[model samples]
Target: MTTISRFTGARFLPMVPALRRAADRVPERARLPVAVGLLCEAVLLLWWLAFYPGLMSFDTVTYVWQVTTGHWRSDHSVAYDVLVWLSLQITGGLAALTFLQTVALAASLGYVCHGLRALGVRGRWAAAAPLAVVLVPSTGTFGIFVWKDSAYAIAAVLAFGACAHLAARQRPLLHWWLLAAAMTGLSVFRNNSYPAVAVAGLVLLAAMPRRWRRIAAATLVPTALALALNFGVYPAIGVQKPSTSSYYAFNYADISVAYHRAPQTFRRSDLAVMSQVAPLAHWSAGGSNCSWVDPLMAPPFDRPAAERLNGKLLDTWGHVLAKRPDLMLSAHLCRGRIAWALPRNDSDIFIQPPVVPADRFGYSRPGGLMDHSRFLPALRTDPPSDGLHSAGVWAYTAARTPELTWFLWTGSLWCWATYLIVLRMMRRRPLRSALALAATTAGLQVAVLVATPAGLFRYMAAPVLLGFLALPLLTAAHPADRLPGADPARRGRARAAARPQSAPPRSGAAA
Candidate 1:
């Protein structure tokens, strides 16, 4: 009876040999990269099919307009506009553009796994790392979104991952080139990234060892070029200066701080200048944060009027900050909490289709605002398939729940954690190179805290995504092995001992 049962089971399990054969075809070293690539492709396809074409916010509309027309505005990064224009030229639609973005994201993540493998992580854990990334709600969902923030976040991840790889490997020329390219993309993708990269470069310069000093130049040079392009080259070509009103956006916290702490300090003349854009009555009602006096809500003033008020706006803000530095600091802390503090904030910048005038988009579906026709033909004019859309919505909703939102929103916290972990590890070994990379990421988070207009989730995306991607690198073992001057003889012995010997090494043999 036992022999008969065994024969029956063998006959039924016909796929066992084929499964083993297929698994055997993938080399052990290649498995992680292969799994990561396939997972990335699957996610991209799923995102495309569900949201088909792509998802967009108001910023997406503005960017598309800027690209379609030659008119350049400083409100949006012309550098990013150029990328969008290039994508449009190549794919003639958003699908291909998103597909390219997916590839970049996957490649950046694969670099992380590669760095981990180099740092002595087991192959199985390295391969499984991508799964953790995909399962993390914020990390995977942002890969599908079509915003400059999304592009900037992806570029930032690549730049950091490349830096990590360079830090962990002895042969770093290739990684250096990769880091340079990624940093260049990062610098151009967002206006705010300039300062972040600059800060990171400084951190790298200060933290890296003497031998790795050249890598500092890699971060600084690209950042300088990006600054030249944004400030010098764009105007040389034909881009118009960004609106003066845009500068006022930075003064929201200032205005709020003044109003809340010392409303009497604001001279009547100061109020008059501000009234040119926002209604002083409404502003007074709104008080010391963006909720009352958002620069976006400020009415557009003609050039002469705007220029005159812009001068006053700057002068008044400077006076307020100078006179009441403490209040300014308090306001910044209060507003920045939404971005840096844990437990998440209520601001959601991921609103799809956007909320504009109903007539603007021609659609009458309940709350539809902008006309769907204004978008490129490639973008889906109607909603996606119900099943796919529903599933995406459900997942997104789940991700947004308070418990998960805390993790999703605390990207800055993650950077600080990375910095602390790297700093701790450096005490016992030569990990300054990796420490520099992690510090750069932390610096970017600090930049967001200092410079972001409000605590919007989108503003924190890059730091959040980067912090998660840097995990394997931060938590890796054998920190000394990846250092620049570690003894090769000792490393060889360690590796030999780590592997199982076939027999006791036959006394006199090479082993």
Candidate 2:
């Protein structure tokens, strides 16, 4: 061969061999983490290419305002706002935020993969598990979206992984710390997660005697810290207390119940407070629980007035429910179905070329861009490419289809299913600790049912993601046998030797 040919051959020849050798060097057990990490990087790249800096919703804009102005809002998590502020300071835009989220998600899922391998899943099966999770539309697609829900989901998975590790090994100080950190993130990232962490912590304390002290500390520390930050520290630092409209957690339920069951539930005096923004007829004619409270009655009430009215309305709500329990229950279930049963949520959740209108919430479009420009310059000029934008539209469209929609919509059902299945599985095997962790994670959906107003998929993303990821752990054949430091090869050989053999292969050649 000529010198040029030799050079070309030398360059090209090692590429395949190099890949094979690299693949061989990666232990079978480590393949799953590597694969998950690569998938996460790919996802981050696709999102960056598609949305450039990042996608934003109305909430995202609000968060930016809060972070930039130092005017904290109780309606949103201060912890999350602080996170965004700090991240923006370092990376200068949503790019860094999204990048960190992708890393978090990859690490969380990799931990799940580690747990699966530790639970006796074959290396190949464990490697394939994360791919399955990634294929689930609600999981992989919504995961990359820029929202507090994304962080909560990552935290939830990390907590689950920590629980699985503790369940299997029942030792290791690192796992305890990991659980605490994960729980802290899970609890603080979203307000609704507070109760879920509380419930899980209680479960851990009650069920996990071996690690109850550590678990209790893990659970309580985060819970207390979250409460302090949200209630005490935030206000001390000049963060506005959440307005009464935001405080009355069950406003939607109260309005829906009153509209449907007791149209006369709200006194004329109470209606007078709401009438500043919406007519009594509007509250009475409420078809949707959300419509009755949001953009209408609730917006009219300022902080102090809202606080008084909410107190009165809550009492009235109680009386209405007492008189018509059946109707009230039905209304609650109906509203919850919107959150838990509907496959597609509001149209704007993942909108491409995000519609930040000029007059939205007192911030003009240009002003908004200028405001965010300090951290995100690409927001002004880099609209998503046509191909990636189209791909996003297509993916979302596919998610809305009947089959895939079920995964997205039925997250609550899956959580319940996981809880029930874990309970049953625990009875037959040594999965008490892991099962308890999963059950608590699944129980988070119940909290969503109680606390959330409308069924938004983002609200339940963490629980749904956790339930799906827990399947391998819940169904492992020999969970205890696969604890850390146990020898998989030795176990495999032992199983092979124990199997009955009809005859030896000694006579194969002669016979």
Candidate 3:
């Protein structure tokens, strides 16, 4: 064969010219990270442009209010608002915030794609990493959307990569530190994320290699940082004071359900305690809406009086629970259903309208990106990213198609997937690291179930993202496949391990 033909065959001949030129720009040492990063970034960029700037919900508008007014509140995530505040300060647009999260989404998926190769996903599976990250709407359409859930969900992806790498027996120097950073993000991004992070941390610590225990021990830096941030920094900044009314959703729902089920048997004093928060009629109105608490808590609900009389409210809630555990159980299932099952309410499952609602809060000043947000007008079908918008909408529709819904939208499905991965990993050595992921994932699921105020998919975003990314593991080639003959060039030197090592390694290695 001519030298040119041989060179052409060896180098980039069969690859598409555009991608070949793009790949040539990346250095060999950084190729995997850069390639996967760019691929994921490209998908997110299209989503952002298609939705131009990104998707938002009512909560996002509220976040904008906090960022615009600088009156930080803890009801949502103050840390996340701080990030948006910083991005707006630096780039003068909320789109910059969108870009920043897109980058994070890229890094997270990139890291997972890279680490999965070390955990045995190889050959075609390895080649499919970039596509895998884009396949799930959680990974594809998530970053461009504005929500604190996106931040914590990205953190969970980072943590999953760390756990996978640690379990690979090829833990990089950055593994534990990456885990630490993810934990800190988890602790700060959501109020309920603290206990979940703690649960995951303990599981990781227990599952980590004994020799690496000290190193893994340092990963708990987030614990102290989380405590300080929650207790110290937040208090010093006067972020948001604790309130007994935080539990009002669940407790009030229980009381409402009890009243609806059997109001005649209920004591008058207990009913009076409930009345201090809202009228008996209001309770009945909201009792039927187990999916949302707005009707019971809105307007005339008298939050101050509820706070003042919280002790009595709890006592009443307890009395109802003891008298009618089944009613409370039914209420718990309805309210926290998203965490453990496919949400029955169609509206609750992945509602990302491509437009940010009009900012009603005067906090959103005119003449800024927030104003541009107001003027989004409509997505032009002829615009460049409008194709992506169409494609994403198509994918979103596909995601709801029976089987895909379980994989893409269901939280418990991913939680179960996580346990299966844990079981697979547990069969390997350095046993402690196996449970790290399960802990983070299932722990979050439990936390959401216990404290959930409504049946929203964002509350369980972490599992959906992490679960889909790890799917290749079910048919993984075994980390050993990446060694020797796996690379035609490396096959020459690897012959000494002998036995002709084969042209390419297959999924011969064990779990």
What is the per-residue lDDT of model 2 for residues 79-181, given as tens digits with 9 covering 90 to 100?
Answer: 7787778777777666677767767777777877777666565655655656555565457655555578778878888888787777666477987898899
In order, the Cα lDDT scores of the candidates are 0.64, 0.65, 0.69
Residue by residue across 1-511, what tens digits does model 3's lDDT show? 6998889886875577868888788765357666777877887777777765666776776676566666577778788888777766676656777778888878877788777665556534543654565656655677766789888888888888877777665556688788778878888888877667767766766666463464445445676776788778887977874566765667877777667767875788988887777788877877877766665678667889888998888888888888888888888877777787765546555555444435433324576435555323321222256567787677666666655655667777778877886678556433455566576786688778777877667888778777777676665554344454354223324645656544655557831
- How far off is model 3, as Cα RMSD? 7.3
- On a 0 to 100 scale, what is the lDDT of residue 149 in model 2? 73
lDDT of 1 by residue, 382-443 (tens): 23587977776677667776656666656657767666667765665566666665745765
Point out where model 1 deviates above 4 Å.
1-31, 211-213, 290-296, 299-306, 343-385, 427-430, 473-475, 479-511
Looking at candidate 1, what is the lDDT of residue 173?
77
Q: In model 2, which range of ten residues has the least summed lDDT?
A: 347-356
RMSD (Cα, Å) of model 1 = 7.0
